[model samples]
Target: MNGILETILVIVGIIWVIVFLLALFLSPKLSATKSKNGGKK
Candidate 1:
């Protein structure tokens, strides 16, 4: 049970790291895309 819990925690941590990195690295790209639209609907 303890081992399983550790594995799950590690997996969640890895996913969180990946999301954090994407947000940091790709935020500029996302902003650029939105700005190109002049914030239109």
Candidate 2:
């Protein structure tokens, strides 16, 4: 039971890390697009 919980926790942690990294990588491009589109809407 404990081992199962630990594996689940590790999987969740890895997913969170991936999401954080994708956001970090794409945010600049997102911002650039927003600015190019005039910063609103």
Index of the highest-lDDT prediction: 2
TM-score of each: 0.85, 0.85
* lDDT of candidate 1 over 1-41, digit per residue (tens): 99999999999999999999999999888888888989553
Count: clashes, candidate 2: 0
The per-candidate count of clashes, in order, stands at 0, 0
lDDT digits (tens) for residues 1-41 of candidate 2: 99999999999999999999999999999999999999875
- Ten-residue segment with the worst summed lDDT in candidate 2? 32-41
TM-score, prediction 2: 0.85
